[model samples]
Target: MPHFHFHSVRLVKALLACAMLLASYAGAAEKLANVTILATGGTIAGSGASSTTTVGYTAATVGVERLIAAVPELAKVAQVKGEQVFQIASENMSDAYWLTLAKRVNVLLAQPDVDGIVITHGTDTLEETAYFLNLTVKSKKPVVLVGAMRPGTALSADGPINLYNAVLLAASQDAVGKGVLVAMNDQIHGARDVSKTNTSTPDSFKTPELGMLGYIQGNKPYFYHVSTRKHTADTEFDVSKIDTLPQVDIVYGYANVNPVALNALVAAGAKGIIHAGVGDGSLAAKVTPSLTAARKQGVLIVRASRVGQGIVARNGEANDDELDFVAADTLNPQKARILLMLALTRTSDSKQIQRMFYSY
Candidate 1:
C-alpha cells in the first residue's frame, strides 16, 4: 500500500510539471517586440467628406493615434509607440522636410528599446524621400516607409494594410541590418531601387531590374536577401553639418536641343548641372558652347543619358574630352541630381564628386 501511494504522488508531480512547461512554452512563443513610428503627413493621414468615405481627401487630416487605432492587429507583432513628427501634405515636402525627417530618424534609432521605425509619407515624392533616407540614416535597424493611395476614411483603401505590413516587417528580427525599406502592395523593397510605377493602382510601388528582397506572407515578413548599399542609424550622412549643397539642375535633351536653359542655369549661379543627353548622354552640337562656358566658369557638369538604362561614356562623340565634364555611369538624371547634391555637400572638387557619381 505504501509503494502504491508513493507512485500516485509521483504521477501527480509529473502532471503539474508538464502543465507548467506548457504554460512557459506558450509565453515564450509570443513574438514580443518594441517599435516606434515617425509619422509625416501623407495620404495615410488624409480624410474624406464622410467617415466611411475613402476617395475624397485632405492632407494631414488624421493624426497618428487614429492611424494606430485603425489597425489593432499590430499589438500581435510589437509594442508600438506613435510620434507625430510632421503633419503636412507630402506634396509640400521639401529639402527642409528631408533634413528634419533624417534628424528625427537619427534620434529614434539611437534608443535601445526601439527595434524599428515606420514612416507614413506622401506618394508624389516618395521615391526622393526613400532615396534620401537610404543614403543618410546610418542605423542597421529596419526603417520602413509606407503610404496610402486612398484616404483613410475610404472603404477599399490601401493605407491600413500597408501600415500593418510595414510594422510587421519593421518588428521582424529578419529585417535588421537590411537598410531602409518601403513596403506597399504586400511587397518589401529596398529604398534605393523602389519607385512609384503606377499612380493610383493598389500595386503601384515597384523595384525594377532588381526585384523585392522578400514578401509579407501570412502576416509575417520573409526576406531572402539584402542590399549592397550603405544605410542604417549610424548617422554617416549628418544633415546639419552638411548644409548649403551646390545648386545642381537637370536640363532635358531631345532633337534640336537648345543651349538657352543651360546658359540660364549658369547665369542663375548653378554650381553644378546634369545634361540629360541623348543616347549615351551625348549633348547636341548646338549646346556645346553653353556647356563649355559653364565648365569654364567652374560650374561642374555631368552628362547623363536620357536612355533608361546603362552608363554614359566619358569619351563619346558628344566631344566630352574637350569639355572636361564627368559622365554618370548609368544613374538616371534625377538620381544624378540627388547624388550630385549629396556629393557636393562634402566637397566641390570635380574629381572627388566624379568618384561619388560612380560609386553611389
Candidate 2:
C-alpha cells in the first residue's frame, strides 16, 4: 500500500509539471508578435504547371490565404495574418498602386493590434515598391519586402523560406526603426540601397555598392547595419490626402544619344525627368540643350547614373549648379523618379529639392 501511494504521488507530480509547462507555452504563444502580411502578388504567389517549371510560370496566381497556409511554420515565429493588397506582378506596379499600398500600410501600422508588416512582391519592381514604402510609411514598426525568383511550383521554390524569414524579421524587435527592408536569399538589404540585380536568380536583389543591411542564418536575422538616409516615420512624404502623383519619367543616355526622347517626355506632360546618364551622370552634348530647355520651362531635371552603381556627384560630369539641376547622388534613375515624384509634391524649388536629394 505504501509503495502504491508513493508511485501515485510521483505520477500526480509529473502531471502537474506537464500542465505547468503547457500553460507556460500558451503564455509564450500569446506573447508572439502579431505580423500582418500584405501580399502584393509576385513569384512568391506564382504557380507553374509542373514542379520542374521555374522560369515560365504565371505570377500572382496564388492568393494570400494559400500562401499563409503553405507556410504553417510561420505560426512558430509570429501570429501571422494575410491580406492581399494587389494581385499584379510588381512590374505592373503604378503610381496609383503605390498610393494605395502606402496608404494601406499606414492604416494597418496605425492599428494597436498590429505589430509589423511583410509585403510579398514580385522581384521585378520589389526594390522600387520597397523604396516607395520606405519613404512614405509613417511608422517605426518593421516593414519587410520579400520576393522569390522561382515560382512556388518550381522544383525547389524559394518562396516558403523567404516568406518565413521575412516574418521572422517583421516580428523581431531588432527590425524596428530600420526603415524598410528587403529579405531575399537570406540577405537583408535597405530599401534605398537594394536593387534587383539579376533577372531570374534567387539572390538577385543586391546592394552593389553600399552593401546589405544584414543577413539571415539558421532562420534568424542578424543585423550588421542600417540605412543612414531618412525614411519611414522620419520622411516628410504623406500620400493620405494626395490622390495622384505627378508624372515623372526616366530617359536613358548612351553614346550619340539624341534629345528627341527628352523633348518627347517633356511634351508629354512630364513634371520631372530622370536622366540616366552615362558615366558619372554625364549628358550627351546633343541632349544638354533639350534638358536646359526643359529646365527653363519649369520642369525638374535630375541627373542620375546609368552605370548601375555609382554616385552621381553634383559637378562630377555635369554642372548641376549652373543648370539649376538636382544631382541624384547615388540614386538610380528609377529610384530618382520616385523621389522626384514625392519631392515635387512638396516643393519644386531646385534648392529645396536638391536638399531633399541629399537628405533622403
Candidate 3:
C-alpha cells in the first residue's frame, strides 16, 4: 500500500509540472502594448563625422526605421512601429509642426490598437513641444518625449538607452493618465515643469520646482508622484480644430536693455509678448515703457523669469495688475510663449489670461 501511495504522488507531481509549463507558454504569448514611435528628428537621429566627434555633426540624418532597428531589445518590451512625422533639428520646430504633431497624437490614441506613443525630438526645443502636447493632447494613454544629448554615432551615445527607456515608459500601464512625460537619463519628468538645465549632458532635463514623477530601474518604471496640475483629458486647451496657433514672441531682458526687440515684435503683429525678465520676472525700468506701450497696443504681455528655477510671483515683483499683464507663475519664457499662444485662442483679457496661466 505504501509503494502504491508513492507512485500516485509522483504522478500528481508530473501533472502539476505540465500545467505550469502550459501557463508559462500562455503568459509569454500575451500581446504586448503597441507603442507608436513618432520620430520628429533630433540629436537622437544625428550622425557625427566620426564616432569620436560629438559637436559640429549633422543632425536629423537617421530615419525612424533606423532608430527602431538600432534598438532590437524593444521587441521584447512592446510592439513598436516607427513613423517619421518630419525630420529637422528641433531648433527649427515651429507652431505648424506643433499643431501637426498634436493632431497626429490624438488620432493615434483614438485607435483601438495603439496603446501609447513615443516622440523622438531634439533637446533644444524638446521641453516646449512636450509642454504643448501636455496641454493639447486629450487622451489618457501615455505620450513620452525623448531626446539624446549626444549624436547617435558618438561613442557611448545616449540615444539607444533613452529611446529604450522611452518605449518602456510608454508601454507601462503606470504611465497612463500622467500627462505628457519627458524621459531622459532614466528619469521621468512631467512636461509642464521639466526643462533643459544643462547645455550638453545626458542628465540635462529636470523639473526644478515639483521634481520628477519617477525613474526607470531594472527596465521597470517606478512612480513616486502624479502631477497635480491639470493635463491630458483634464486640460482646457484643445488642438482638434486648431490649424494655426497665434503669433507670440519672447524678449530677453538685460542691463541697459533696449526695447528694439520688443518694438519689432509688436510691429510684426505679435499677439502676445513673453518678457524673459532678469529676476522674479522683473523688467528693467528702461524697458517698462516699451512693454506698457505694447500692452496698450492690445498685445498680451506675460512676465517670465530667465532664471532657471523658482516661481515668478504674481503682483509682487512685476506690477501685473497695473500694466494689465499676466505673470507666468512657474513657467519659463519659452514655455510661457506656448501657453500664451493657446490662451489667446480663448480670451485676450489679461485677467482671464492670468487665470489661464495660474490654472494651466
- Listed per model in order, the count of residue pairs whose N, CA or C atoms clash below 3 Å is 10, 0, 0
Q: Candidate 3's C-alpha lDDT? A: 0.93
lDDT of 1: 0.81
lDDT by residue (144-242, candidate 1, tens digit) is 999988888777888999999999999988888888889988989987667777867778888776678889989888887676655555324567465
The candidate scoring highest on lDDT is: 2
- Residue 18, candidate 3: Cα error in Å is 2.8
Task: Report the candidate with higher TM-score, 1 versus 2.
Answer: 2
Off by over 4 Å in 3: 1-20
**Reference-based lDDT, residue 240, model 2:** 94
Per-residue accuracy of model 3 over 198-290 as CA lDDT, tens digit each: 988788898867899999999999999887778888988888997888999999988889998889989999999999999898988888999
Candidate-wise lDDT, in order: 0.81, 0.93, 0.93
Once superposed on the true structure, which residue ranges of model 2 sit more than 4 Å away at CA? 1-22
TM-score of 1: 0.87
